[model samples]
Target: MTIHLANRVETLTPSTTLAITAKAKELKAQGMDVIGLGAGEPDFNTPSNIIEAAYRSMNEGKTKYTPAGGLPELKQAIVTKLKNDQGLEYAPSEIIVGNGAKHILYTLFQVLLNPKDEVIIPTPYWVSYPEQVKLAEGVPVFVEGKEQQDFKITPEQLEKAITPNTKAFILNSPSNPTGMLYTKDELTALGEICLKHQVLIVSDEIYEKLIYGDNTHTTIAEISQELKEITILINGVSKSHSMTGWRIGYAAGDKKLIAAMTDLASHSTSNPTTTSQFGAIEAYNGPQTAVETMKTAFEERLNIIYPKLISIPGVKCKKPQGAFYLFPNVKEAATLTGYESVDQFVAGLLEEALVAVVPGSGFGSPDNIRLSYATSLENLEEAIKRIHTFVQNKTK
Candidate 1:
């Protein structure tokens, strides 16, 4: 029998980061020493306090369906977190918790978009953005952020991308592939354009707590009251507290939109995991020492490995201000190494050198590749050495 699938499902591309990581695992399973830098997850364990909270929740018989959106306690905690961290206040009614930040975003697109509505996504973007918009029957308009601009799109560029069909602009600061952040002034300028054009802003701040050096994370919604009304702030404990498995994330914005998302989630997922919600509550409300420790470790790793990466011939990288990924332009390296593209170079590194890095083609930067420093300094050093050797030998 010939089975047919929806066109949306047929057209979706598998996540490149996951694909590379899985390939690395397959090689490792065959006894090759694969050093994978493709995973975006932190190598750290969940903080003990959060774990204990989940245990307590399970022991106390809290492992059941929660409110379709989230528990009041969890929602209130999120409200407090937003106020304390970003100085943005929100009522509980305006928030809805989903399985993770990814889920929240997927649901948001479904609720906010109509068929043929357009979303402006700046590249290089998280791999899922364009796919998610397409799943909701929305068109993704890509605006390339030039490499020289630290991979951040300018306000003028944003203004030119807007069309009558444009519904929202997706902003991921301390962006996933590039790890670059937008300054307060930069965000304000962008927000002004969005306001003038009456486009909704979806600000994904999952990496807010992982910043380094003098750079800071700012929410575009915090720029002004008007912007806040049009902005949907998406965040989660996964990146900040190493609670990826906990599966809890929330969104805050217009109450009507929140209600729609909540309704959609009710039928699709019902609610986030009960115990995970409790864990996330503790993650937000408990001591944050572990989060800071993880951030410091990532920063130290970046300090040690970034220079080594750039020291290789035909490589150039902008020092990332936040997040744990290093996106380096390797077009010259690819050309020198006799490869036709960055993807070929990355595949050769994995197959021969036993190192895994994601090619930037999926992130909309075909000339670059993304390496994650979320692993230990020892593994990172070895991976860099392997990459350097591979590049040199290929060139020779």
Candidate 2:
């Protein structure tokens, strides 16, 4: 019997990290040691207080279904967080809590896009953005954020890409693969363009709390009242409090858009996990100690390992201001080592050097690769050492 899938599923590209990760698993199963540098989450456990709060909630008979949008307390917690952190105010009615930021984005596209509507996605993007747009029967128009420009697209390029079909623009500060941030002035310039053209701004600030070295996180919505009215901001506890598994994320914007998203979620997800919402409540309203500790550890690891990573022959990296990943152009190393492409270089590292990395092709940039520093400093050091030796030996 043959079972056909939907056209949307047919058009989808599978996640790019799976191939290298699968091969790494096979090698480990065969008794070969492998170091994986593709993690997108923090290495720390969820803070103790959050866990206790969830347990308390479940024991207190709070394990049932929550409102489709989310619990009032959780919504209020997010509302309060935005006020305290950004001085931006939002009513509970303007927010929708979903299973995760990814799901929230998926739902947002579904509600907002028509078949030919266009979403302007800057290249070297998080893998899911374009795919989600396509699944919603929308078009993804990509403008390259050139490596020379710290992988950020400029206001001129953005304005050029806008067309009558343009519906929204995605801005991921401290971007996933490249940990570069948009300065306040750059954001304001971009915001002005969006205002003139009437394109919605989708600000994915999931990595908001992990900034380092005097860099600060700013939502474009805070630039002014006009920008605030046009931006739909996405955030979650996944990165901020090391609560990836807890699955709590929210979106804030105009009440009508949120209401539409909530209606869609009601039929599909019903609600975010009840226990996780309670845990998220504690994550926001709880102590600040653990969050800072985790941030400090990540920054320390970045400081120690970044220099070593860039020291390898033919590799160039821009020091990241936030997020846990390092995106480096390894094309020169690949050519010097007799490999044809960065993808081949990544596979060679995994197979021969016992280190796994994600090729930049996955993120729409083929000349580079992304290595995460979310593991222990020891593992990161060993992996860098292995890469350095492999490159040197191949050239020798």
Candidate 3:
């Protein structure tokens, strides 16, 4: 019997990054010593305080469903977080909490977009952004953030992409896949363009807390009140606090848009998990110690591993200012290693080197690859060593 699936099912493809990770797991199950660098989350456990809060909540019988948008208390916590961090204030009505940052984005698109509406997505993007736009019957317009400019798109590129159909522009600071951040001046330039065109801004700041060195995160909303009104800021505990399994994410924007997403979410997820919301409350309201500890460890590993990674023949990577991934342009490396494209080179890494990394084609960049350093120092070192040797051997 043939089953007819919805068109979205055909349009929304699976994640290529996850594909590499799954294949690496398959080889590892067969007893190969594979060091997978495709992780999208931190390797650390959820902080004990947060886990204890959730456990305490469930034990205290706070296990029932709360508001569909989110528990009011959780919304207040998010409001406080924004005020403290970005100086952007939001009423509870202007906030909506969903299962995760991804879920919040998916819901935002569902409520905000009509068929044929276009969202300007900067490449290389998080894998789900374009797919979610398609699922919502929206078109995704791509603007490249070239490697020469540290993978950050220029205001000129953004203005050129907007048309009458353009509805929103996604700004992922410390962007996934590339791990590059947009400075305040750069964001202001982009925001001015959005203002002139009346296009919305979707600021995905999931990695705001992971910045290294002197780099600081600036949400577009923070630049001015007008930008704040035009921006929907998305963030959650998944990365900042290593609570990926907690599945709590929220967005702050105009109340009307928030209400629409809340109504849509009521029909969809109903609410974020009861206990997880409790944990998220603690994540924002609790101590700052554990978050710093995990970030420090990631920086140490990056400092240690980056030089070795660049030592590989024909490989060039910008040291990431934030986020856990290192996206390197490997076209030269792939050619020197006798592969036709970066995709085949990625496969060769898994099959021959037993080191797994995501090909950048997944994020809309064909000549590069993304390696997540969200693993142990030991694991990252071993993976880089394997890749370096693989390129050297193939070149010989």
What RMSD does each model have against the real structure?
A: 0.7, 0.7, 0.8
CA lDDT scores, all candidates in order: 0.95, 0.95, 0.94
Per-residue lDDT over 1-396 for candidate 3, one digit per residue giving the tens place of the 0 to 100 score: 999999877988789987898899999999999998999999999999999999999999999989999999999999999999888889999999999999999999999999999999999999999999999999999999999999989999999999999999999998998888999999999999999999999999999999999999899999999999999999999999999988999999999999999999999998999999999999999997999999999889889999999999989999999999999999999999999999999999999999999999999999999999999998898899899999999994
Error of 3 at 84 (Å): 0.9
Better of 2 and 3 by lDDT: 2
Candidate 3 Cα errors over 4 Å, as ranges? none
Candidate 1: regions farther than 4 A off: none
lDDT of 2 by residue, 1-396 (tens): 999999999999889888778888999999998999988899999999999999999899998999999999989999999999999999999999999999999999999999999999998999999999999999999999999999999999999999999999999998999999999999999999999999999999999999999899889999899999999999999999999988889999999999999999999999999999999999999997999999999999999999999999999999999999999999999999999999999999999999999999999999989999999999999999999999999983
Cα-based RMSD of candidate 2: 0.7
**Candidate 1 TM-score versus the reference:** 0.99
Q: Estimate each model's TM-score.
A: 0.99, 0.99, 0.99
Query: Evaluated with lDDT, which candidate comes out highest?
Result: 2
- Candidate 3: how many backbone clashes? 0
Tens-digit per-residue lDDT, 1-396, candidate 1: 999998989879898888998899899999999998987889999999999999999999998888999999999999999999889899999999999999999999999888899999999999999999999999999999999999999999999999999999999998999999999999999999999999999999999999999998899999899999999999999999998887888999999999999999999999999999999999999999999999999999999999999998889999999999999999999999999989999999899999999999999999999999999899999999988999899895
Please identify model 2 stretches exceeding 4 Å from their true place.
none
Pairs in clash, predicted candidate 1: none
Pairs of residues at least 3 apart in sequence or in different chains that clash in candidate 3: none
